[model samples]
Target: MALALSLKVAGLAAAATTILGVAVGFLLARASFPGRNVLDTLLTLPMVLPPTVLGYYLLVLLGRRSALGTWLLEEFGINLIFTWQGAVIAASVVAFPLVFKPARAAFESVDGQLEQAARVLGTSNTAVFFRVTLPLAWRGILAGVLLSFARALGEFGATLMVAGSIPGKTQTLSIAVYEAVQAGQDDVANTLVYIISAVCVAVLLTAGHLAPGRIARR
Candidate 1:
């Protein structure tokens, strides 16, 4: 039961990560400032890096020793490292690239000329984005969001390294389920396995429902 709760927390982390990823994707797709490639590469770095490496870097940044960590503890009394929240942050950051790439692809697929036409008709760029581009790109964004959520739900190395499988405290389904399997407690792990399997099916189903053909009105 506690393990299942941890999984729930992890699920929240995935949702938060998808939200952040969508924002980043929007910026990357729409903005054309200098150093754009650098920003794009940075956004994508987490996807390529080993999960362990990304976890390690995050640990250094948010560990009890870091100023931000210390401030979080001092000001908000919030401790991230070794907590469920840390697990969420780790999972989200690692899964971010998955979300951003698809969302970016979706946004880029929109014809700039259509937006320009909207602008010529007295629509502001923001209005053009909201009215013209968003409706067309929503499917891609939804697809990316589903993919990111799935990746976050399955995050193992980063969640383990940062959260340390502390049973009810920090042990998410991915980690506790592993421990159960390793301890020959296959039955215990089975529950989590089924849950993850169900979640995967649900996300894919959602993506299908949100496919461009469905989201777009003829």
Candidate 2:
């Protein structure tokens, strides 16, 4: 049950982060607003920062002390610290860069002419995008999203720091494995390690197959 809950939280976190990654990737690739470079750096920050540091920042952002965090509690009654949902947020932030990089690359590969042709054929820009562009670049976006999902699944430091090692709740497979190793339970940790490895291999292989040119050309 504990393992199942961790998987569930990981899945939820991965999905949330992947959604954020898609929008960020699209904006970074197609738009050049002010402070674009800064935004890009911030988005990529988690990749470099220690997971504990990322968790700390998230705690500040979502804790009762922060103004933004307080407003969330006052207006929406949503407390984000030290909760299962907070685990999701922490995992998502850490995995965000994985999703963004691939999706942006995929979006960049799409030929502008195809979208233009759709527009010329009386399709609106939004329609052309969903009908044409997305179909062409779906593989890359999917690869990115899958990578993010896998990263979220294995997130340990941030998840543990922000969410704590609460069994049947915030504890994820990575956290469980960490605890097992710390307590000298090598066998349990080894089994969890094997599972993580299997999951990573399957996701990465699928991502490889979904990469550009893997699918038959239209």
Candidate 3:
């Protein structure tokens, strides 16, 4: 059950990350504006910041006392604190940078000349991006998606902070292993650890297969 929940949350987070990451990444790769560098730095901050610090920021931003949180509660009665939804948000926040960086790199690698030619031929920017740029960069974007999913699956500190490891509610695989170890259940911890390791390895292998050229370049 914990494993299932973990996958569920991670999957949802990864999907959300992919949508937002792809947009932000493409913008970063192709567009330039006054605050582009600042936006890029802000987007990538989670990668370098400590997880606990990130969690704390999320808590402050989404907790009931904050304006958005208060509006959510009053308008929709949707509470993010200690909910599975909150877990998804926390995981997404931390995993976003992982997805963004590779996706941005992939977008940047695509031949700008091709896009320009397509535009000259009367293809709309949206059509050109979807039919040209995205298809060309899909391999690296897929790798980023896989990496984001793996990162989301393994998220611990932020999840614990926002979701509280509630049994059968937000107790993800990582939290389960943590609680198991705290209770001296070595066998349980080991089993969960092994499962997580296997999942991570599989994701990495698939990602590598998808972007062998990128891997080789790195």
Per-candidate TM-scores read 0.87, 0.92, 0.97
Highest-scoring model, TM-score: 3
Checking candidate 3 for backbone clashes, the offending pairs are: none
* Model 1, C-alpha of 131: deviation from truth (Å): 1.7
Give the lDDT of residue 199 in candidate 3: 100
Q: Which stretches of candidate 1 lie over 4 Å from their true place?
A: 2-7, 208-218
Error of 3 at 79 (Å): 0.5
Compared with the true structure, all predictions reach lDDT values of 0.82, 0.84, 0.95
lDDT of 2 by residue, 99-138 (tens): 8887788778889888888898899978976898788878
Backbone clash numbers for all candidates listed = 0, 0, 0
* Evaluation by TM-score, superior candidate among 2 and 3: 3
Candidate 3's TM-score: 0.97
Better of 2 and 3 by lDDT: 3
RMSD of each: 2.7, 2.0, 1.6
Which ranges in model 3 have alpha carbons more than 4 Å from their true place?
212-218
Model 1, backbone clash pairs (residues 3+ apart or across chains), number: 0
| lDDT, ranked from best to worst | 3, 2, 1
lDDT of 3 by residue, 1-218 (tens): 99999999999999999999999999999988899999999999989888899899999999999999999999999999999999999999999998999899999999999999999999999999999999999989999999999999999999999888899999999999999999999999999999999999999999888884955677
